[model samples]
Target: MSKIESIDAKAVKTYARTEQTVSDVRSYRLARVIEQLKISNCPAILLYDPVNIRYATDTSNMQIWTVRNPSRYVMVFADGTVISWELHSCEHVWDGVDLDLELRSAVSWIFFSAGHEVESRCATWGAEIVNVMRDRVPGESRLAVDRLDPMGTSYLASKGITLLDGQAMMEMARLIKSPEEIVLMNESLRAAEKGIERMRREMRSGITEQELWANLHYENIKHGGEWIETRLLASGDRTNPWMHECSSRVLQKGDLLAFDTDMIGPNGYCSDISRTWTVDETKPTDEQRRLYSTAFEQVHFNMDLLRPGMSFSEYSEKSWKIPDLYLKNRYSCIAHGIGMVDEYPSISHQVDWTTAGYDGVFRSGMTLCVESYIGAEGGTQGVKLEQQVVLTDDGCVPLTSTEFEMDWL
Candidate 1:
């Protein structure tokens, strides 16, 4: 047996074979997609987003580049039929991962490829999609689509297809985690910790912010982690405004460095973690200490506040209320769902409820990140802290293992 096939389902089921061929994560995720399709009354989903495709079929090709290209795609029917298309050379790429999926050469009708023939080529792509939907899924004209170009959209619409929100269904399905997935996620989290540890060891007065940030990427890739979503590492003054991408500026001994490791780690699970640290052997300023303490308070307070049965609105209402000094520069949401990427239910703050709030219940098996960014309106420095956790009947079990700078306080 191959390593993926030999993996113990009780141990690392993520790489193990699916139920159709053997048993484990590939089957579990596909079942989640099917369950979601049925709940949404969607006959099938046409997946163009590489992340969605990866979630559905356990396969990939040029993941980042194809995000905007739409050249690679898949169709997953509610009845459990899966058909995928990729570059001709990649026809056998998925091989043993999903035994039931049919693979073919994907159509490329983007302007870059088709030029003057974009329309006609798009029509051909649309017709093939419709034919497959009719033949495989049979009666449903309603197709859930993650994304499509205008030509493809108009063409599919003219042919009596109603495109439901596939991304919503996928997000809903992804919010809850299976036991097996947690294992893979923890493995990815370990990769991130290795990366963070590298950063901590190399952190010093003379190191540039870019040099520090590169350590995270190097550790992630060296350990089989795929990518980091953001370049959010800053020291000293750059920390004050927040969201500053890492730069080449040399650091000073007492500077406060902050970063968010939006890493898409192994098995495509994300480790969206953040922390602020002091550069080298220097005493933190009183202002710096205050910021770290406040941010930590917010993160832990909200992390403890959440429960399995609480509604999203109630959670927000009773959640950590940001004080006046730090209100303006709050993190976008108290928390958000995490899976292959930042997935669903971005719980806004109470002040943001008027426009951004939505209602839902926090449920068991859902993984979340509690967030905090503390900086006064015109402050000179700030602290960003976040914790990744999974909810169960007991309470939040932390996925993040990085120790906070508690000694600084």
Candidate 2:
């Protein structure tokens, strides 16, 4: 039996909380933002992306809601000063206290006024931005912006302020994690493992795929998780082509269930883990065993090839080659960097380097997720496995601890 299956549900929960501890996560994350500003040669950054704002300012109010409406934003100067703007009434969510940064309510007049609302709001918001820039940034200083609406863009154009790609800069900064960040990531991984344990206990024939997926969501939220990234959970024939999300399909006596937990846990760090299991009272069929073992071998082989100072090109060239039959339906990337969820520096297959790959040297402190999927285009089912690891001075260390389903192997 796998280590996860061997443990009882209560033991799994205890293990998840064993190493939980507090750290100065805010300071560490701010330091990273400062480092990014220096590297990118920007005087300040205007962050519209909620994730980047959360990283720079260490504050969040209705994060998921902000993704669509974007009712919040943050401005961080290279001098370490931060200003956050949120919806006026939503300030109560933070209990009337900002966490380690200046907080202000956004201009909500557009909501109350109807005539020329967009133009008026944009102009007013532009004036506020100009005022902040005058105070925090010098004359003719270049500003980086992650994203902006059309109105905001037009206003900035009128102001003649240059905008750089602040999203790329933030991704570069997040590529390597700090000690405190690692602590939060470890905590997140533990929470994810607990969720996986719950799924293992609940997996069986006659359960709907959505029901199984709900088990993970319930466990994660109960353990202080923020949100799950995707719904890529499938069983039976849905597992063959891959990328199939959870549905109402009921699992049968002998079916392969595959899922990827793109979980954003405590402190906003992401834990990207994938596991495949068999929903059977007896052992898996020979075809099922072969597929599972191939995927397992692929994951470990690529993980073993990881080391500090390896070039992305070199790794891509030397990585495992999926069989011809399985290559057609292979996942987009063999491995990808993960911090806030698939950050940067994706290592694609060697054949795909010229088209879809990036060039960089893997450095110590970089965290990555090795991915594997083995299935034929017309096959009945497939197996997928992924593991999270961080590069150390000598070798890579695992971040996720959930074991592979042994019964399938």
lDDT (0 to 1) per candidate: 0.85, 0.80
Superposed by TM-score, candidate 1 places the C-alpha of residue 115 at a distance from the truth, in angstroms, of 1.5
lDDT tens readout by residue for model 1, 1-409: 2232223323432333234432466888899999999998888998999999888887877788888788989889888888888876887668767447787788899988889999889988989998988887687799999888888989999999998998889898788787677777877888899999999999999879999899999988887888888999999988987999998999999999999999999888899899998899577888888888889988888988898899999999999889998999888899999988897989999999999999999887888999999998888788999888877765677876689988876
Q: How well does candidate 2 match the true structure in TM-score terms?
A: 0.90
What is the C-alpha lDDT profile of model 2 across 10-42, one tens digit per residue?
332344322222335566677788888988888
> What is candidate 1's TM-score against the reference?
0.94
TM-score of each: 0.94, 0.90
Q: Would you give me the overall lDDT of model 1?
A: 0.85
Off by over 4 Å in 2: 1-23, 92-100, 108-116, 406-409
Instruction: State residue 248's C-alpha deviation in candidate 2, in Å.
Output: 0.3
Off-target runs (Cα >4 Å) in candidate 1 are 1-23
Clashing pairs in 1: none
